[model samples]
Target chain A: MRDRTRRLVFLALLVAMATALHVVEGMLPLPLPIPGAKLGLANIITLLAIYLYGFRDGLTVALMRVVLGSLISGMFLSPGFMLGLSGAACCTLVMALLLKYTNCFSMIGVSLAGAVGHNLGQLLAACLLLQSGAIIYYLPVLLIAGLPTGFITGFLLNSLLVHDRKSGILRDLVRT
Target chain B: MTRADKILLAGLLLISLLSVAVLYGRFSIFPAKAEPVQAVITAQGKLVRKIYLTEGVNSSLVIQGRVGPATVEVDGTRIRMMGAPCTGQVCVKEGWIGRPGQTIVCMPGEILIRIEGAAPVDAVTR
Candidate 1:
């Protein structure tokens, strides 16, 4: 019971941190050269979730972050909201699944996969809604951006996991 | 390689292909000419045409809906949305638009401002 409680507490903290990072990113006044690119700070928590609690937990946290993050940011139903939600969900799922089974793959490999998937999902959603389909022109640009951002987030997550070592949520939860 | 890795790799490949197809179809197959577009402004499935801004010497402006009929003022290469019944007054705030992809949307009055570029080649030929 103690271990379960501790793990739950850790998960809640992760989710809260993820939400705060998402909101801060949305609110930041950075003049990103591209219209829709960022460091994707919330993705750190997402990557952490994947390493700590398996695929489903990572997915749940990511989805929650997107929905809540958008609502809080007053971007409900806007292109930005849809883009964030779809990209985060797709990326988290793919990364988690790949990492769960593959031992040879490193952080960089997972990052590349996640970044590519993220862009694809957003582009697909945009094509369906915009009807003009002109948005796909932004893909190559988004991929180029996603590659570097994904690498940075993946690297951060790997370091966090390495530092936390066995005391992470995965072990704590498995005890219950 | 495990069955799972192969499956994941295959899925990734499929996603990449789809992305390429979408990018190709959007950029290469479509004409880039900006043309006048007539969009039906619908609220809960009710069609209402209010304001349209197309590029031309003179364009007819319509603002007919539940609120009231408002006069549209046109300047060279631009259209101004005059009076509107919407609370936020975003439609009126939109002032003038001459660009190809500009828009003014009044949710309350179901008014939409659409800007289109030169007529499509097919339309021009016809």
Candidate 2:
């Protein structure tokens, strides 16, 4: 019982750290001309969660990060918040499922799938909310932008895992 | 690259190329600069009121027809039906729209404002 409690505490701490990263990344602007496009730094934590914990835990952390991140940003109840929420949820679901099925797929492949899923979700939500199918016009640009960003995040996550493995930090965290 | 990686990359490149091509086809390379049209608000082609979009570029024009009051905001290089007494309020929610091929329409007031502008520039022309 004590060990379980400690594990829960550790998980909660991870969630908090991920959420913090989400908010901080959101504040950092991209040099891109598009309004909403960015590096999606928060996704790093989600990818890490999947590697260190599992799919379910990674998904929970992602949803919480998006919800808490939006609330903190004061974008709660706005169309923008809804878009972000839907996008993150769908992306996490798809990525988790893909990772579960394709045992041999690399982190890069999973990240690409997540990026594609994210863009699709946001586009669908925008089309529904705005009642304008014209927003689909943005999809190509969004997809093209998703590639390099997804690869970068995936690479970072893999490197972190490697470092953790070398230091025995990953095993320690898992035990806790 | 692995076979799977190569396939994915190719697919993505194709999609992006197609999107650019479609957009280019729809919009002219060099957009024709438009002289702001002096329009008269009308119902069923009958002139109800006349307002010059040039003078009130940042302001709006409200036309109260038999239905109700119809507010039209004339912004730089564009005109929009800002508000209406209609139930949906869809037009008002459209927000600041300055792009061509975009419009705000109030069915009750029978008011439609088409924002006039040059098409997007093409890279080839530039």
The candidate maximizing TM-score is: 2
Q: How high is each candidate's interface RMSD, in Å?
A: 8.7, 5.2
Per-residue lDDT for A48-156 in model 1, tens only?
7787788888888888888888788888778788878888888898788778887766665676678777887888887887786778778867776776677677677
List native contact recovery per candidate, as a fraction of 1.
Answer: 0.03, 0.13
TM-score of chain B of each: 0.45, 0.50
For each model, chain A TM-score?
0.86, 0.91
The TM-scores of all predictions, comma-separated, are 0.59, 0.66
The candidate that wins on lDDT is 2
DockQ of 1: 0.06
Which candidate comes out best when scored by DockQ? 2
**C-alpha lDDT score of every prediction, in listed order:** 0.70, 0.71
State the lDDT of candidate 1 residue by residue for B53-109, as single tens digits: 444556545666556554455655676667776577777788877665667676666
